[model samples]
Target: MNAKNSIAELARWIDALPNTRRLAGHELHNYRKQFVDGWRIDLNLAENVSINLLITAQFPFVSPKIALIDRTKFLSWPHVEKDGCLCVFPPNTNVDPYRPVEVAKSLVAETEALLQCLLDGNLDDDFNREFDSYWLLSSDDLRHQFFSILPDGCDSQKVAVWSSSKFRIIGADEKSVLCWLKNRLQKDYDRTDTGFLVKLSKPLSPEEYPDCTEALLALISEDAPNFLESISDHIAKSFQPLTIILAISATNGTNYGVVELCRLLRANEKVSKCGRSNRVSVNGFRDGKAPLSVQLSQQTKYTKVVRSPLERADAEWALGGRGHDPRFAVLQKQRVAIVGLGSFGSFLTDNLIQAGLGQVAMFDGDLMRWENTGRHLLGGDTVGQNKTDALKRRFETNYPTIVSCESNPVDWQQRIETAESLDGFDLVISTTGSWKAECMLNDLHECSGKRTPIVYAWLEPFAAAGHAVAIMERSGCLQCGFTGAGQFSRRVFDWPAAPTTMVSQAGCGNEFQPYGITDSLHSIAMAVDLSVECLLGQLTASTHRVWINKDRKIDPIQRGWSVAWQTVPNFDTREEVVSEFPWSARPDCQRCS
Candidate 1:
């Protein structure tokens, strides 16, 4: 229905209610914009409070918004935004377009219920739960200016701070914060200042929240006295702005708040230094500095402070805490080595890194060329760079949750020959699609006593099929799937004329199979799924997974399905599908048996 009709229906519905009325000209004119229109609702509360049912322009598509009119006292309530909107529904709440009146009724009901809870003080405890939301209610442009990487703990201690002209970063230690700074700034930093970290047992309510520098100190002295003592001297004597980081522990998680003491001055102090009236001098003597204990009490009453928002920038918070992805807690401890950074490997590496792996060591000898951009994750920006190096820089810059991203600009074969052992990695993935490299990786697995699982993935010509084979200890060897001549012994499909379709843009030996980027999605997914399964200990035996592009129409003159595929039921009718098969060591295989 049109918006005008919907609003008319809504107005008729609200007219049936006793306490609600359509706002008159003056009040109605204020809300008669293209984006919103609504009637005022006089909530049946003890105090004279009213709310507006704001029917948005997208009316039925988006549920009506509820806004509290008398917002002065309600500002401290949970889920109340700075502009007086009551966030009654959780994020991603769906709306039924056909039931616009019912949707509006439900939202109004939820708002009233929430307001009643506020009246009874039942939601005061929720202040801690929605601490960050309330903390960011300030209109300050510096709300998102500070970032904290401090480790999660209740014990208060000193933290490292890196200050720029507009931004500041707080970290648990010097080395970690410096590393983060280097990664972000792309430069070396040798110096850092100290900040006081104060742990609050509980977050403060809006009324208890501090507004000025003196109020912050009062809060620290009241709740975090022990921490305040440790940093009192540092704050009193600092010539530059001093930082205080609050790690308020809430039931959901820790919420960080940052306040900077921009200036220190006494009641009668002026902007002067090294003079009789200078606060820096001891007892009006220019030669001596004031005592630490007295400086805070006597001269810091009017200290100017900037309250900025604090973001948790550490890997732990980014990977596991924010998204609630439990895999990070386990996968972040495991190390995986990717032996290639081509089209297949590059995307596979990206998937693993985004999954929050702790350490990912990439090895690839090839440099990215313009031809690889269509299928490869590394794009034109890194066309001339080594694949591994370019990917390393890209991943680290993009995925901050990745604790360690190492790149080796050498072939996997050469890396294995030089390294002590491949056993150090939890798993090794080879997506180079080279049989020779796969054989060498198999040897490395054997040399490591099968300590590390290995996954080999490749796409057939035209991407008609893709396969991922996992080699586990005592289960099978890489040769189990292939004959000594590098052809699958139990191939799913056969295309004997596929070799004739190979195209070479650079040279005769540097030929690449023709396939669109979309055709290889299944291949990359298969490899990534198998790799994660192996790392998570979900796969106990060697296995092979194959993805068949059932929609692909083969050239009947030269290509056809293999005999092995024909035996499968409904093989011809099936759409794109992934089939799993057990991989066991072949009895006649010279490598394993």
Candidate 2:
């Protein structure tokens, strides 16, 4: 329908509503400049509420914006913006172009429901649930720039703040602050200020929120007089701006608010005499003035504390859990050892790092060549660097949430020769595609008394199929899967028993399997998923997972299919799929016997 019909339909719906009329002339213009039409809803109730529904020029495609026109007394209410706009729907609510009338009707219903909740005192508790929204509403993003690396918790303690003229960063300790600065700014600072962090028993209502340093102290003094005294002492010593992060243990979750107070004066500074030695004097104080601490206590009332936005940049929040996700909490404790950094291993390590693994030990001997850039996680910038070192820099710089990443640029055979080296690891993964290396890792794992599970992953040529086999104590060893040599006992895609599809580049040693980056994602996913399961203690027995790209056309050099392919139902027709099987020992396998 055209814009004309859409506006007319909205008008009809507003006309049908009770106690409503079209807002016209300068009245509508005063509220919204670009609206095609608007309506005023006078909610004839005790509190005398009035709402304005402005239908914008992009109606039908965009929902109408609702404003509470006469809401001066309701500014403190939850979801009520400073501009009197009611957040009836969250941002990015989609509108049906063909059904403009229903859209307006639903918004009207939402606005009514919100007003009812406000009158019933039902939204009073929402102050805690939506505290960040209201707190941020009062913030000036340009002036109050800050980032927080502080771990979210309900404990009140002394935190550290790194402040400069441009911005500030608050963290749990000096080390974390310095580490974050190194990761963000590529530089280190030697100084940090002591900051106060207090956990409130309950979130403050708008009325209880303090606007200045003295009020903040008064608010704290009620329950934590000793903490307030400590904060006063910190202020006396600080020569720069101070930060105090307020955390409320709300019913829903921990809500945060930041208050930054400008420095009143430097505690001590040296003054040069006309022609004599320098003399140190306490700045902003008379020689016989009241003690600096006592004066500071009195000066705080005039010092304004502006509310700043403190974003959580810690690992849990960066991992997308916002600190409450158990899966990430568990993953953050796991230490994984990746034995290779080839194409498959590179992508698998990237996935596991993104999944929030706490620490990783990487072993790869090869340097990244230009040929590996297309599929490797490390880009061309690190072409000459060792894959392990390059990947360590890449992941640590990009994902600072990872606790530690150890890169051993030696051959896996030399680095992990014994099981003792893998003692502290939760899981050991070998994606080397070298059966010899995998055999050694398997033997080492068995020698370690099967304390750490091992997972071996590899991709078939042309990326037509991939496999991830998990080896644990209860299941057969890695040798059980392979009969002899590098060949698996069972194969999904078979070849015509001629020359394989390996291609040679300029040199005799340069041979590579042809595959694109996108084609390897599924295979990477299979290995990372199995590794996560083992880390999370979700897997009970050894598991074998395979992904087949059945859509790939069978080339002339390729045989049709093997018996393993027949196991998947409709294998010939399905485009792409994954299947799982138990990695049980074959009765004739000598390793199991």
Candidate 3:
């Protein structure tokens, strides 16, 4: 048949098939194209192929059958049965058959498998084994039977067709024809070459592995060949020795456990990468037979103590006159308030307390829930206890002399009011996103008589991202820092078009969700660094400052830029300070004006 006539005939056959008819015209066209274009199969072979279809419209469906007429070169079931009748079944068949859709799905899947088998080389031993049972039938008998069963006047020798068959004829050779029979009959072996096999040998054992320090040196030597040979003397001179500490758990016995340490050391008055050391230590109680915990302490001249906030304050004060205390210079008189006492808030409060803040206040309205055991700083026994009260109790227990305030009824709104009640603080930190509370605080700082510095830090859902905004009074408030509004002297507070409700129920709330320990640690580090900088008068008094480290490619250090503040007609005011406590112009604000 001509190409056009063959295509028309194939199109008619496909349209008559119930499964093919259900697919959209475009989808069916694409499906046909996958074989004709992708596989590059010869259309002439369709006329000589006798196709049979068996669809199981049940729980587990099967594919249709296909066979080659006049040529029994490569034939296998369900393409050719024991009696030489073609039978096709689906890819995965259970005891029960489902529906026609399921049967069609099986046909498509099996067809894909057949195509892949053809590509990977048809010397499949399993296919040969499965076809052995039907090998007894003579090739002439198979051809005669196929031609007889075909549609009247349909010359089997001239018709080449494609069908959904588990068995597929791939190629014809002088000796034996290549085909994909059934998965169970095909050999499930990987034909990797010798070179690949050698490379796939077992990995070196831990003890047999090269030392990390040596491996690093070797890598540098190979990667920097040109530089290494030329700078051998300079490299030697650059080498420096430094110490590091490797913390190990008790379960890791000595001798069997390894400790790795790498550090930067001073060389020629500059810090450079020094060599690393690895050692295996055995536990003393294990008779040296079992692995022992290994801990390595790098030797250093300076001794640093991680102390609580009050202790750090006292230490700084005692050493301030001597000029030897970095804390004295960093924490002179820093005041910090933490709003929200859930997992994130509690973690931040504890860290700040340890950082030696002069004064710290924690605020939260919700009580601890049973689900907070893993996230909360409080013990599981403290479940159902007020989060603020529990945090305060934990703080007092750890540091009796430290002065910490716990505000139970003070939600974000009351917290802002409470903050206003206290003496003007240097920095106000808030983790809660209570819109009402944030609005109140923004208004108070914007129009209130007091001009206290405010910093807002929050973690996005799943702790995937964190946002921090440092607002210098009259400089750039949170609303002004938003990308929408450029630098403006007049505060532009745009409320969200739709109200965003934060879930409060224990397990269902988003805000109440606890961040991973690593995220919490990172948040604490950022909060502490910013607060310390503000306390030390290191922060720029710019109108806008945003702290973000989303892209790891960027330096992980605390860095930000300043934007010039522009004057807005209704917002900018050069008045030294508001004369009255409550300004009437911002009366439209739902929070305090």
TM-scores, all models, native as reference:
0.89, 0.88, 0.34
Error of model 3, residue 346, in angstroms: 1.7
lDDT of each: 0.74, 0.75, 0.38
Candidate 1 per-residue C-alpha lDDT over 1-593 given as tens digits, one digit per residue, 9 for 90 to 100: 77777788888899888788766656544543443577888876677678978766688788887877766655467877655677898987999887778888888778878888988889987878877777766414363478777766646777889888777888878887778776666578998888888887666886766667668878788767876654565455554677887778887778777777765555676654532334446556342365666666644654666766788777767766574777777888999999878888899998887777789999999999999999889889998899999988888777644678888999877667733468778998888777677766776676667868888888765676788889888787887666675666555666555554331111011235566678888778888989998988999999888787654554333446777567644454244777887888888875777
Q: lDDT per residue, candidate 3, 1-593, as tens digits?
A: 34344334434555554433222334224321122211111222223222222222221222333322223333322233343333334334442232334444455455445534433545243333332232223111121111001111111111111112222121112111111111212323222100000010122222222234334224335433443332222222222211111111122210111111223333333432443322222234222233211211112111121111001112232334323546654553566667667666677667666665546667678888777766667878778778887776676555432433455535756545654553456677776754445545666666654366666665443343344556664344554433222111222221122122321111112644444555445655665666666666777663222222233323222222212213332332222221111112333323322
Best by TM-score: 1
Encode model 2's per-residue lDDT on 494-568: one tens digit a residue. 665635433111001122656677777887898899999998999989988888765445433564466645664
Can you tell me which runs of candidate 2 are displaced by over 4 Å?
Answer: 15-34, 71-74, 141-144, 164-167, 182-189, 234-237, 264-289, 292-294, 497-511, 554-556, 563-575, 586-593
- Global local distance difference test of model 2: 0.75
- How many clashes does each candidate structure show, in the order listed? 0, 0, 35
- Comparison by TM-score, 2 against 3, better one: 2
Kindly report which residue pairs in candidate 2 clash with one another.
none
Give residue 48's lDDT in candidate 1 (0 to 100): 69
If both were scored by TM-score, which would come out higher, candidate 1 or candidate 2?
A: 1
